[model samples]
Target: MFRLAHISDIHLGPLPRLTPRELASKRITGYINWHRNRRKRLFGNILESLVDDIKSAAPDHLAITGDLVNLGARAEMDAVAGWLANVGEPDFVSVVPGNHDAYVPGSFKLACRAWRPYMLGDDKPASSAGENLFPYLRVRDNVALIGVSTAHATPPFMASGVFDRRQARLLRTILRQAADDGLFRVIMIHHPPVRGATQSYKRMLGIGRFSKVLKEAGAELVLHGHTHLETLYRLPGRSGDVPVVCVPSASEAPGGHRPASGYNMLTISGGPGEWNCRLERHGLDAQSSKFELFHSEDL
Candidate 1:
């Protein structure tokens, strides 16, 4: 079986410090709340617990969907890299940048500079630019992992992301190639493929076009973050079915009666056309020292 752990939005600590550009862009309604609650030790504790959980689970690979930083600050990226290093193997962990990771104009550059050692593999470059922001692809014995960067620094009140025409085209080509190679293609990004009817303008502005591309190319699964909520949606393709799973923030404060933070473990088995997915949820506990299995999705 190919076991993979999916986690997202672990806004790591030493929080609330913003760049001049980021501070200016905080006029949005939700921005203040994110800053106020995101800086606490609670987030760090939750992250620590998550690392423990991942170590215990011991998945063959780990995929983090993004938002590792609160405001794209250099210190925050450094902190996130340190936290990931403490967790386990860095090469097994693949990540894409979220909107928060690109709060400033050159935020990606800063992230690359700070997190290069962990992000780069033996075959991959230490840093990528422009359309190659998420240029890494791993084809293991049982899984094909594809990561894409959907982070873009937008105007205040507009939390938008664009893969750009070049990246979109390359992604389609990659998907087609992966399908042809008979691999279980898993696409990872920071934005959802379908933003729902109540979608905010600030959330994945070009998802429609993005979805169209994916539908045409085809993939077994697409994982994303940035919604800060748990959601599952199915997208039909001509060749087969694709399931898109969105995970909540791994360290966000619980809202209403909902669990604050959680992650998904996907087990892939069988072969080619007979592959199956089993998704299990792990929630943060009171001590924030471990994650307990809260629920399991029907297989």
Candidate 2:
């Protein structure tokens, strides 16, 4: 069996600290608003606990669907890179950028450059025909991991995302190739493929098109992060049912009760066309510093 662990939305670093003058003048109002709603300062320790938990579980591969930083600040990106380095084993971890990771213009590219060393898979050849925003195809012994960046910086209060035409087309091609190559394809992205589950204002803008491509390609499983809630939804495909699993944030607390911070461990067995998967949730107890199984989904 092959085991894959999926987690997302670490949002590392504390709230931005603006200069007194800037704050007083409302020059940094955006930062202030974000801080007011974000998890205050619980992310770092929570992430540490999560990493320890993942280490113990020791999945064959790790996929992080995005929002590694809160505002795409350079310092936050650096912190995120450091944390990933601390938790990730080379060739085992892969990530895709989320909307927050591209908070400002050009920030997504910057984060990709800074975090490239931790990215898994072979370097693309010069003639490769995919969007180069860390969009990659990774071949593990038992699975083919295809990652795509759906991150885009939108206007303030607009958290919508887009996959762009290039990435969208490339994704179709990659999925077809992987299927022909006889690998269990797992597509990872930051935004959920389903629509209406998200707030109407912040929904993934081009999700319809994205979903169409995915359904046509017939991926075995799809994973996304950004909802900050644990959810499982079935998307129809030509071959059969495709499961899209959305993991809650590893560290987040907007209000009310904080959902459990954990990751999904997926075990796949049997050959192509006869494959089966069992998903188990592994969570960390902050007080005890121990990891335990929180839930399971039979698939």
Best model per lDDT: 2
Error of 2 at 243 (Å): 0.5
What local lDDT score does residue 297 receive in model 2, on the 0 to 100 scale? 75
Q: How close is candidate 2 to the true structure, as a TM-score?
A: 0.89
Model 2 stretches astray by more than 4 angstroms: 16-30, 120-131, 253-255, 284-289
lDDT of each: 0.73, 0.76
Q: For model 1, what is the alpha-carbon lDDT of residue 199? A: 58
lDDT per residue (tens digit) for residues 1-299 in model 1: 88889989887765655555555654333356565654542356666667777778889988999888876777777888777787656667877778878876777778767665545533566455444445457776668888888888776666677766776787788788778888888888888767662257646766776777777998888899888777888887546668888876887655434457788999988776777888888776666545778788754
Clashing pairs in 2: none
Question: How does model 1 score by TM-score?
Answer: 0.88
Q: Against the true structure, whose TM-score is highest?
A: 2
Please identify model 1 stretches exceeding 4 Å from their true place. 16-35, 40-42, 117-123, 255-258, 285-290
